[model samples]
Target chain A: MAQFRLQGSKVLAVDLAGDTVKARNGSMVAYTGQMGFKKLSGGGDGLRGMVTRRLTGERMEVMEVKGQGTCYFADKATEINLVRLNGETLFVESDNLLCTEASLRTGTSFTGLNGMASGNGLFTTKVEGQGWAAVTSHGPAVILRVSQGLPLRVDPGAYIAHTGNLHRALKSGAGWSTLIGEGGGEAMQVEFTGEGLVYVQPSERMTLGGEV
Target chain B: MSYPPQNPYGQQPYGQQPPPGYSQQQYEQSHQATQAGMPLPPQAPPYQAAPAGQFGAPLFQPPGGEGPQLWDAGTLPANDNVNPYCFSVDLNGAYYLQKGKMIAYYGEMRFSGIGRGALDQLLERNFNSPLHASDWVVAEGRGKLLLADRAYDLNSYDLEDGNLTVRSGNLLAFEPTLQLKQSIIPGFLTLIGTGKFVAASNGPVHFVEPPVRVDPQALVGWADCPAPCHHYDHGYLHGVLGGLRHLTGIGGASGEEHQFEFIGAGQVLMQSSEALMADRSVGVIGAEPGIPGAGVPHQQQQHGGGLQGLGNLGDLGRRFGL
Candidate 1:
């Protein structure tokens, strides 16, 4: 087991004792002790997963870190979030996934049209198994919970990830007014239902549907 | 994937079932535990329970990261900020928000354009900036709506039977109870009556009483009684050499020659920095003859109808008893 803790808000320190952890390629800022780094093609999900990642455009280039010391990982100094997963899956943008435990399974799942407006692709990365996965965002991520009868609506640009067996539907508020300059700028949205947790950044990414 | 714009209200789309949920009991306990900063007793498997509150964007890291505090729906504040950069509006009726500013929300809500719709009557009452019509939307329903603007510093102000004028671009959202109208000053919008509103600034906002002169770019807005006028320091315009230098920049001009002088009573709001939010045009007031602020354009008025370096002398000649 790797001890995942924050050295600061922007850095992730994972202490490993001979076990390996998968992390973003070239994300090491500093480390103390012996460490081995190796690039893993296809996110270490295997050949089938590699081809699936290439096809879905949710491609993640990662490296395996095996050692007996504390390894630091960071991405352009963006805020890092550490999520502990037991068995359930975590769905996140491939670009936002900074690192994951080697034991976790990584693959892609069709996100329907929700990715079209977000421009992250029609697929997103799914991480499962027991491990701590670290994600990044432009600003701090606000974790929101959606339970039975209490659904959540999130802007495509602000959405980062989610967990649980929730159902997602792509929604568009576009109409005759949208054709005019008077259209609501938030003409597109993603609606989530069922049980789950959602991650949204305090900032929004520029998306195809953002200007409507 | 295809959610119709007019989907029936209160109906779940796509045959989605809520899944066997964490009993309300378990959720309440974990929520309390997290709120109390108590170690979660592992009432449920970490894999089975949904993580509530915040993670990732840590405010401050303790000696060791036990993890940041989380805020679930029950704990997320109503009509307050989740962080300095994010605000939450507990919406039971309606709110007017700048378009595309919402990051997330829980519950049912419908966002509609301010133009021709059932919102016409409401828009007629609260929304008055027609040029900015394209930049705003009316969100109606019940939910906790989160808002942010490019991750800037956000603050909410309560206006009770009072008025405050703000740069159109800095305002994020406002309650419908406040009537919004175009300010007599172009590029600014005035909100009258009561209710609360959210505004973002490059830095935290600072308040100062009027009878003060401020840099135009640093000013956010003012509340009541203070009238803004242009001011210039004419110390160097005494000789022909000075005149030529002022005209050619040969002797250099003090960058602080111009400022907006305010007098009388009232409060002036200023952001720490001069960096401004992108301007959203409130549109022209029309070129109608005899209307005081019509046709001249705001830029020209603010700049005194000419370039700053050369226009200062002309403006001085026009001022009384200078």
Candidate 2:
């Protein structure tokens, strides 16, 4: 088992004791002990996974790192978040995944119209199984919990990822009022209900739709 | 080894992680069921707030864990920062925020554009920037609202029987208890009375006692003082080379040409960076006579008193874009 920890907010330190982990290609900045790196064609998801990745355009180049003592991974100084998975599923943008354990499975899933509004993609990357994984963001990600009576409304551009059982609906306040430029600034939002956690970055990404 | 040059598209070619749950195959099995109109089982119920060693569901970590610190409707702060870059305003009444600064919120909240609806009455009392009213909104009702701006450093100040003037673009939100008025200087607004307001800076803000001169680009705002005036280091402009450098960009001119002079008893705020922020106009004061930046006929404008013999009226006229 590889122990995943943060060197700081920006650097990810994963300790591997004769185990293998998959990381974004070229993300290794430094490492100690003996390590072997081999490029995994098509996201390390095997042949069919590659085909699906190519079709979805959520392609990622991953490398398998074996027998590493302590390996440091970082990408452009972005803040890294570590999530431990005993057995739940995480849905994230393909571009936001940094690294994960080989025991976990990565795949693609269709996200319906919610993707269209965020200007991300029609399909998002999904990770499953047991193990630890890393995610990156422009700034620290704030995790907000949603449960029975508390439904959370989030700006599509600020949303990064979320977990647990939940349902999402694209709520819009746009109308003739918006046409005349009197539209409320919070016109476009994604409402999450049920029980789970939603991760939102402090900064928003510019999408096809104007800030809403 | 070369990692990808920062994504040319700026946003693409990037990462994500997920905590393990019951199972991926199981979620997929139930995901399809839920997608097909069969109501799926509810996820983990709102777990009691995580204690020191025990973790809650996906959203929260144990008190000392890497998971996010959870703040529910009752636990969120009233008018404090959730983080350095994000502010959580517990709005019981109304607050004015630059349009589109909100990232997320919980509970009941209604956002309305300014200068319209019942908001006009509210604006009539608290707002004075009519021309720029379209770029603002009134967030009313009660909720824990989160506000952020482009990930800049944000700080909120409390004013008790006092006042503050800030650059229009830097002011993110303010309480209705403070009356906002246009400052004598262009591109700034003055808030007087007692309330809290949030502002953003290129970096953390450094508060300095007044009787100071600062680079205009670094000056964020000042409190309880008369308008600042320009101070030029005219010693450099004494010779012909200086005149030529000022007129044409041929010779290297020291980047610092002037500074804003602040005097009297007050506080001056400056950001670490010198990059200036651009803001929309707070409304045109009309071309009335005697108004400082208003409608004076071009010919009547005066020349700079500092560069007397070196430049004449024509050169000075162009300098101020008269």
Candidate 3:
């Protein structure tokens, strides 16, 4: 467990493994996982030197902060980016998780939630808060906010953050023939609906895994 | 096939029948003429006669006919010691700034496309510049200056070693190395002059001069003062993928920026300061005092127009010599 301190509505803590301290507002909930960081001067002295190193591409472990107030976690993963969104919501992710404060929500039921298909099982760890929430990512994420009548769909793994109110559904790109190959057709999908935000990693899962 | 000439009861008409065996040659000629269609009216040849020893249209054909032939494939003598200022691409295509006038790659001047026309103005006026202020335009960049739309009111003063100097009326300077330019916005001008600066709304700014001493308070100032402006973000977005022309960048993915269309309107997006480098989500804060459209914040609107007149009107009224 990482140690965290509270300041006003914000919580600051050092990631024991990653040696980095993270601060977040109490109104926000953050999850932690093993992510990478690189060495640099920690932005603030209150932050430990080890934490700064982690921020600069040093890998650290991951954890989830349920209640708000800032919480810090570290991992041995590199590449960290923070994205901000509307309504003071922030989304955090590790390994190419591109989420922002605008995408925080508790539920899903939107047009773009599940590739235009209804009843798709698309679930995002939603956070409903009114403060700054910090998220991390290995690569950049593309945020797209679709409006009413127009929906959005994305690969579940590619989603780093999203809003809660957007409806959730599952879609299958595989047709009947393709389904036969996979124990009777279970295609990968996570659909979203209504008017809300969706964040996608710039690269698709196929390309990213190919690189690895 | 041979046919007896229609003689109207064995009488030959003028220009109708030729001597025997001449018909085959005539048939061949007619066949070729019909296949080729009517001949074009002969005019002076398009290209001047190729000088001796110079390759011409025939050279365009592949030597073995194995690969598709392309014109202008042969390499020419390389040019040495070219200046960066001389060779750059504007809207139309690659061009060279020879003497003072800009010369296009194809030597034609009339622009045929809107994108090229915009590119023309960008490269000629905004490349490798920190600030360019004329009567109609203003530009800011790191080593390259970029004049945004509606910028003709700019001054032409070259900075040494790509150093940027802001004129009294001008309020923009960009650092080339960092590829960032500083321009006027609420609460940014005075603070940017000092290395200690702040970006209020999560805007990306290249430090013209490094922060001599990194102070947390100063860093806060740096974080709070300059929120990236709207037009600049568009420009940066257009050029972001230039770094990776091949892969792992914008070029490899789409080789184009995705344009979102507005409902029944031209493509216009609401500009905000927080989404400077916005990737996934955009955060918008209506700092305009009082709820918009309910009651106009008269004082806020007046001050928000700019920091120049609102701050100095009172002082200027008192110090008049006349």
Candidate 4:
């Protein structure tokens, strides 16, 4: 059971009510339950200023809320939808994946066969077969076509998303290093070359998701 | 019991017997005539008994008198065989000391295990290093190959031929040229052939074989430090974790940016929504320049330099006194 709703500014809402998931956004959506606001204090002007700036939705430090129930307002979201794939496997980010059809076995980065403590320790849920998979993000996700002949190398830090039969390796190219602030110095890049779909974040997220 | 002389080629034989201390003439004659196919005096000379006044009993004189017994095995003292092909479940330490390729060391060692120093010590001590004489010592010290060390799969083990095969493990220190068979099992490490071997928790087979070429570079990738980053200190653990992240993608970022402040030499302030902000905040005060606090004039306080004139002293006095 799943549904979509539009409400508040440009914020997209994915509501999981009982057995169904409802996606809503626009001005019509409102916080019906209770409202709680806590003032942030202390710290110097820079940090305090940043926190205060976040309230206006102009800062990069954005707080996102996702769970079951209702929400009042959301902003800076473009599009939202449900995507499904074959095989007994589903790869997704910790934040993007909202719910799964089958029971998921949650584990740390080390639990994987060769999974390292990489990607800023991003938690991934390996879903088996098909059922229901719900996901959300700050903005619309970009699905890029990656194949064996024309593969893509991305900085893991800039990797917003990806899915498929993908093998990851370390990558280094000329233009890619320029953005790293020093010829990419110990810049570790993620090489995704295979028949799979990759999602990339527009901006670099400083979650320690780059080369070691 | 005496051993017959070993023929280099199992099927053939050398010709006539060269007298003890065979003259060059005798050697040439023996070498030329041995292939005639007649078994004459076993072709090579018999074991030579010591003459009257000689020091030790002469076991057997070599065909060429100058060297040790060349053709007679009976001349030499008997010793146990260390053939890896043979092993008894009951033999335990003795067999492994002679056959195993990797051995663990529980503590420290006085000398490098392979060199003559350790071997000499081993012989003197009656064959006991860490894992025993039979086990080929793999690591030298306490943390060499810990139990927590990763595991792989074993696929084949032909004991008769002394050949073994195994699936790759997370072992950064494996020999690449070593023979192995590859197979995939989604969730478990499975054993394939026979012979003593270790199995991965998820099921991968691992077994022993004769020493083969091992590519140290390929096996270990690169050390934790020595990475491309200049700011990377070998002691910094973050880069190691990050490498693991880059390598395995096990724990990825939480899709949030974070700011870390170097409070002191060893202190840090990680500022993120995920951080424990209940009691501790994310910023730093009095932080040195080029550090966390944007442009704060860093006060260089010496370690042993106590706060004596700190209260009364204004500028130079406080700066110099401590």
Candidate 5:
């Protein structure tokens, strides 16, 4: 198994010994030992994932790094977060996924209207199985727990990812006044209910619904 | 040799234990202790433990009992910062914020633009800058509202019968107790009376007393002081060579030739960087004669055409080397 650890808040250091890890294309900033880099034609999910990503417009350019030594990966100096999955699934935007251990299975899932409002399309990338996956955020992402009666409402642009069993629905704060340009600036939100942890960056991306 | 027993979650590899949640009292003590010693990193968990509430969720600890502190409604601070870049407001009544500054919120909240009829009363009392009306919105109802702006450093200021003038783009949100007005200086807004207001800076804000001449890009705002005036280094443009350098970059004009000069009793706020936030339009002023920046004819109009139809004569003098 490749060992994934943070070199700092913004860099991910993965120590591998003849093991492979899937990472964002061109995210490898430096490496200390023999490493083989291969571009996975279709997100490393084979033909099915490639086809799903193409059709859903959730395209992810991924590269496979196999080697023996420490490899560092970073993206635009954004903050990196490491998540450990114990036979569970982690759903995140493809743009926010920095790298994932090859042991984790990567696939695409339909996110419905929540994705459209966030300007991220209708499909989200999911990493499952047991492995360490790294996610990127505009800032240090805040992890909020949503369980039972306590629900979490996230601005579409600030939401990065979530894990565990949860239901997401698009909730609109717009009303009749919104029609006349008096609408709440936060016109669209993703309401998460059930048990899970949501990751929200302290910064908002420019979304289609943000100005409303 | 074994990499110090890597934890399953990989959080232990760093070896620095994530700080435990501190109750209000403990937080205060730790804060004072740290203040007495080495300062805590700016991103250190600045939130306090949740006050007991009806819907208190179990504090979330990541798989290895580590990672960023998990925040929910109960734990969110009231009118305080969640991190240096994020602020949490315990909203019960109403709060005015620049549109789209909110990242997330827990509870019942409605965001309405300032133009709505329902917010007319609120605007009449707290909002007076018609020019900035379009750039702001009101968050009302109950719950915890989070406000952030491009992940910049966010700090909240409390004004007690005082006034503050900030760059339009830096002012994020404010309590209703403060009445907002347009500053005479273009691209700045003034807040009067008492209440808390949140502002964002490119970096941590530093306070300096005037008389001070500050780089325009580094200035965040000023409190209880008169607006600043522009100061130009006369020596930089004194002679022919200086004028040529200023005009055509012949001798490399220093970028610090111009600054905002402040000479008053109050404090001036400046960010550590020279990167200025995108300026928000403060709206057009009445084009009346004798009004500065009113789009009326002025002596120093540099643009080609003037209100008097003078054509491109503004630059004709430079062509003749006059």
Candidate 6:
């Protein structure tokens, strides 16, 4: 098993003892002890996942790190968040997934129109199984819990990932005013319901519907 | 060679003891006094201190794990900052927010643009800046609305019968009680009346008393002060060589040659870094005579109007070392 920790808020230090972890390709800043880096073509999801990723445009470049020391990973100085999963799935954007334990299975799932509004394509990366995975955000990510009746609405640009059972629906605030260029700048939102946790960064990425 | 006095304003030198009643502490005390004296609205949520672990060191252990603080709707602070980069507004009635600054929210909230017919009366009273109409929207209903801007440091300031002028892009949202108007200064907006507003800065914001000259890019806003005037370093533009450098770029000019000079009694807000927020159009002023930024086309105003229109004249002059 590999243990994940933070070396400051931006760097993720994973201690591996004859275990393997999949990370963003070339995200290794530094490490100690023996380490081997192998590029995982098609996100190491096997041939089927590679074809699915290519078709869905949810492409991810992954590398497998197997070593006996503390391996460090960072991506563009983004803040790293650690999620511990137990027989559950984590739905995250490929751009936000920094690393995942080899025990976890990675795949793609259709996100419907919510993906089109966020400009992240119709498929999102899904990490399942019991393990620790790392996600990246523009700033420190705020973890919000969605329970029965207490629904959460997120601007697509700030949404990074979520876990547990949840239903996501595209909520549009666009009205006649939006067509006349007087619409709410937040014309589109993703409404999440059910029991789960949502990861939202404190910043917004420019989206197609951002200006409207 | 003798050097000219750097403190050309003839005021107290920088870092010296400020006169009585003008100290930073006194300003903060008076600021708090005003806040304390103000009456809270009926629907306004009770203000809560920001969560302890949201900033700096974690004072309390995480609820159930070793990760960041997990905030549910009930745990979210009411009308307070979730972190330095994010502010959570406990929304009941309404708020005017800059376009697309919302990151997330809990509960039921509807965002509408200023052009909605129902908002006309609200706009007439609180929003007076017609040019900025397109960039602002109204958030109404019940919920905790989160606001952020490019992950910049966010802070909320309360105004009690006071006024503040801020860079247009730095202001994120405000209550309806505050009447927003265009500042006389280009690219700045002024808020008047008693209300709370959230603003974003590239880095942490430092509140400094007036009698200060600040780099334009570092200035976030100012409170209860007259607008600042541009001050060029006289010594930098003194000699013939200086004129050549200024006009022809024969020698590189120091970027700090120009600053916004502030004097009198008030507080000025400056960011820690020189990085500026993206410029938001303050809307086109009427092309009337004597308006500094008027008469020029909107696109030309962004690049600074005068010399840009001359075009190759400057390049041609630089070629001959004019």
Global fold similarity of model 6 (TM-score): 0.84
**lDDT tens digits by residue: candidate 5, A21-46:** 99999999999999999999888899
DockQ of 2: 0.27
lDDT of 1 by residue, B1-322 (tens): 1122332223443213222344445544543422121121122212222223232221223334434444445555566667677887878899999998999887778888888669999988898888777788899987679998877778777776778888888888999999998887778888888777888877788777878999989988877668977787767865677666666778786788778898987778888899988775555678876555687543444434444535645554333222
Q: What is residue A110's positional error in candidate 1, in angstroms?
A: 1.3
Candidate 6 collision pairs: none
For model 4, fnat equals 0.00
The lDDT-based order of candidates, best leading, equals 6, 5, 1, 2, 4, 3
- Please give the lDDT score at residue A195 for candidate 6: 66
For candidate 3, give the lDDT: 0.26
Scored against the native two-chain complex, candidate 1 gets a DockQ of 0.34
lDDT of 3 by residue, B1-322 (tens): 1112231212322123432222445433422321121111111112222222121111111123321111110110011001111111121222211111111111112211112334445544333222211111111111111111111111111122222222212222222112223223321122121111001112222231222222211121222212221211123323335322322334343322222121221111122222221121112224466533223444533323332331222322122211
TM-score of 2: 0.81
Model 1: which residue pairs collide?
A: A81-B56, B53-B70, B53-B71, B54-B70
Which of the two, 3 or 6, has more TM-score?
A: 6
If scored against the real structure, what TM-score would every candidate get? 0.78, 0.81, 0.23, 0.27, 0.86, 0.84
Off by over 4 Å in 4: A4-81, A85-88, A99-119, A128-132, A172-182, A209-212, B1-322
Per-chain TM-score of candidate 2, chain B: 0.73
Write out fnat for all predictions, comma-separated. Answer: 0.56, 0.50, 0.00, 0.00, 0.62, 0.71
The TM-score ranking, best first, is: 5, 6, 2, 1, 4, 3
Docking class of 1: acceptable
Model 2 chain B: worst 10 consecutive residues (lDDT sum):
B9-18
In model 4, the Cα lDDT at residue B152 comes to: 19
Tens digit per residue, CA lDDT, model 2, A24-99:
9999999999999999999889999999999888889999999859999998887787776668888777778899
Q: By summed lDDT, which 10 consecutive residues of candidate 1 chain B come out lowest?
A: B35-44
lDDT of each: 0.76, 0.73, 0.26, 0.29, 0.78, 0.79
